[model samples]
Target: MAPVALIACFPCRHSKRRCDKSLPTCQLCIRKGVDCCYPKRRAQKYIVLPESNGVTKDTVPTGNDSSINRAGGSNRSSEWDQQSPLEVSYATPSVIQSFGTATAIQFIAPSIFREAFLEIPRINIAIPSEVAAHTGEFDQIRDISATFFSQVVIWTPVIFRKNFFNIALNPLSPRRTEGILLSLCMKLYCTPAAQDHRDGRTALYKATKQFYCEVEAAGIMSVCILQSAILIAIYEIGHAIYPAAYLTVGACARYGIALGLDKLLVDLTGENNAGRPWMEVEEMRRVWWGILILDRFLNLTNPLRGLTTKDPEYDDYLPVDDWTFLNATAKPQDNLKISAAFNLKMGVFTRLAQATYLVNQALKFVSSLPPPSDSDTVDIGKDTAQLRRTIWALISVTKTEFDAHDLATCCQTAISYCAILLLQDCHWRRVRISSTEDAYKHMFAESECVLQNLALLAICLRKDAEEGKSLGEEFPVFLMQIVYQGALTTIEMGQGSPNEEIQERVAQYKWLLQHLQSRWRVAGIYLSILQSKEAIMASIA
Candidate 1:
């Protein structure tokens, strides 16, 4: 009989080397001064008795099939398969208990969709032979990368500007993650709708995927890797490819969680190493918030789908002002100087994040309430009144903080208006058409306020783009959806009176949508509605 194979020491097994099976410490582990551990013998394989007839035979649980052990096989669906929101408990069990059983649902990038993410095959397209000039290609990528940092990075401010340039500036140094980020950025800049740049988009996408797989397989985790994923997610969102974005951001969130980014390390006692810059801590916080923003926005865009990050725990403050971020060189301490201007600018997104969380909570609460019959009108009114109070309170808080004439203010106001719209959206449409005096009166006032908010948003967008101060129609994809919502509201309101200013505003939206329609499908829908409404108005005149 063949001699039984010796089980290797843990160190040797981990290093994939031979072990002599010596006592105390193996020779190799002793030489390396590493601890030597031995694994327990595997349990004898046994058959699992079927609980019912016609069930397939199951094997004893093993390390490779731990998931199967939990589910009793690969076939059973968990809570995720039902498309339910993930209820993330607080990191501290004590805190969670004290916070009450509010049951917040964070849209985590569910593992149920892991198969779909893995299905994005590794692409390996080569660069064109004609463009094989190494120096030329390098310069071109750097230029596109600059465009990405300046234009695209604004939408997802998780990436640290200085660090990105370090890799981008030195093209000769082999950096796979940076290369993938550059390629994705190039693709976003040269989307298919750009007509002249369409060919480059596909090439960039293939190259990005190729490099991403290679880097991912190497098991690398760093800020650059996380930033690359965020950029790719943003690029996917710009093209309205949500599932792909969801997958990318989901992976990004996993990486962030693995890095413990949700909590500020600086806040933890003695965790900061001597040389670790305050910026590193800030970077983690920014990346965490960026992930949260995308997670909430993704769910907001498609309420039907399960969320990407569940009840995310964030104890960090909102990002500091741009002036402080861009200018400060010294290590920052507690009480970092904040810029009112920058706060005014970012307040919309900050409040939007909070509103989204509230919305999720509200959704959970609403779902739990017993369904009411038509005769049970009192219960429905109570629920509606409670929701309205919550929404108005949120609006009051947001409005009080930043009340400027900028896009941020306009966006927040629109969101507050949307809260009211959300409650009565279905009936509001009916109210607009109803002959009842009370219904018409209510619809007219709400519709007018909504249109004014949208008009301000449109003007802000138009003015910013026209003056070349904006991202050239590459505005936040979600914001574009809001603008489109405003357009629909404009159409509904304009059915009664098509005044010159309203007509002019509609024309401006039409002009803006023409530029955005390629990247955002909602813009295309808005353009169609605006054009159709114009045609109808013309026919009536």
Candidate 2:
């Protein structure tokens, strides 16, 4: 069985700060001068139930199935209304212990290398032949590739499909290795949790991860390898794989820098840009952007941590628009129509990137604010006003119900509103600490407006859900962060509310995540957070 770890404290839970949940007091609470209150709680045995029909097999609860446990076999779904998020299956500590902890190097490389490093004269390496690099059955791989492109690609798009199918599918060709690595990643991402980790890591995850380590050992490096790392990181994150998720993404940032991915778009405007293959460059650019996006999104739970990559500069070029993804004549930054204010025209991936940028900005802005006691005399209204306007500019311009069928766009929309929720939270907290009535009223009015937009968008999405599938059956699995943030936002700040409107939103966002658990167990982790929040609110009342 996956070993359980301690949960976050109350302040950490509310603010997304990292917590070790130590007894007496936590380090974060000590540093911040905040109350370190662990819930006065006890454990109870949870029964696992089978998922209903029409549910994706992967959604069945796995112990850290990837990012979080799934809804499958949980008699707990209905219990959520009466339960706390504390019950989310947690196995990340053991994952870190197994992977690269100080006490043991339990995964990939041999522990002997670590123990006898100075004693060994030299480390010998083996090179595998082309046949040894072989992945899986051709037809099965083909189907997996198609499924990935059809579903997950709309958000991540790590590889370009048109070029991939044309050049890289051959097991006989040199490009076949990259295709195989990418295929391996998609298979890991797509495989259901039904047969996944019950007491230990699943067979498929172990095999794919081993193959990835082998490729690295064989000196394989490319955009596809990075994409594979990203898939693993995403999987780890969804399953709350913790330090592994953190470390995997940090490696991506470093590897991206090592590969000079930061220069991909910058090189586009140079005189030497003429001969470069636009498709290959696009793929490279997307991979780099993927690293950047993941780097920021991963830090959402710990906003004060230094980002692996620097925040995006105002003119940092965005990706080639997703719709014109195959356009041969398209030049990088040609699609950018910059103005003081502008419409969201780039594409869904770009939209996701933009929203992530807002999240980063919110983190920075909030981090810069002084504690309420100190900031009481500071005139920071201008700074707050400018930041609020910047958030709304994106939210106001986006097509609220644009292409309801495009799950990527839906994810993008949800994230943009999440930024508002994040910002309003900062403001709301400030007002409460200062006991400023004017500030509270202002925040309430503005937050209400922004939340109404989010609610409407959720309604449009709910309409599209199939009759029997989960509410979020069609959403991309990577959207768990945004959905979780939205769910947390719907609860009214300060006094507890019986507001029907607030309850509707709270239920709606929860429904989106509850159903999405079918494909990605990450949803279950977020639901646990909601449960924890409910417990806190209940205690206060």
Give me the candidate number with maximum TM-score. Answer: 2
Residue range 327-405, candidate 1, lDDT tens digits: 4442344322121222344434455545554555444444344444454333333456656565555665656554323
* TM-scores of the models, in the order given: 0.57, 0.67
| lDDT of each residue in 1-541, candidate 2, tens digit only | 3333366665565457788777778877888775555544423111122223323221111121110111121233221212211121222322222222211221233333222210111011222232233334566667877777766344445566665654245432334445566677777766655424632245666666777787665443456677789888777766666687889899988877655577764555322223346666676777777888778777666666778887775666677777677444455545452231146456667766676667778778766777787447644444556666766666555655454345334655666556666667666555553222333464644456656655665666667675443444335544676667766766544234435666788788787677666656777778888878867765664
Candidate 1 regions with alpha-carbon error over 4 angstroms: 1-138, 170-176, 179-192, 196-201, 264-276, 312-316, 328-448, 459-474, 490-511, 518-522, 525-541
Whole-model Cα lDDT of every candidate shown, in order: 0.48, 0.56
- What lDDT score goes with residue 168 in model 1? 47
Candidate 1's TM-score reads: 0.57
Top of the candidates by lDDT: 2
lDDT of 2: 0.56
Q: How many backbone clashes does candidate 1 have?
A: 9
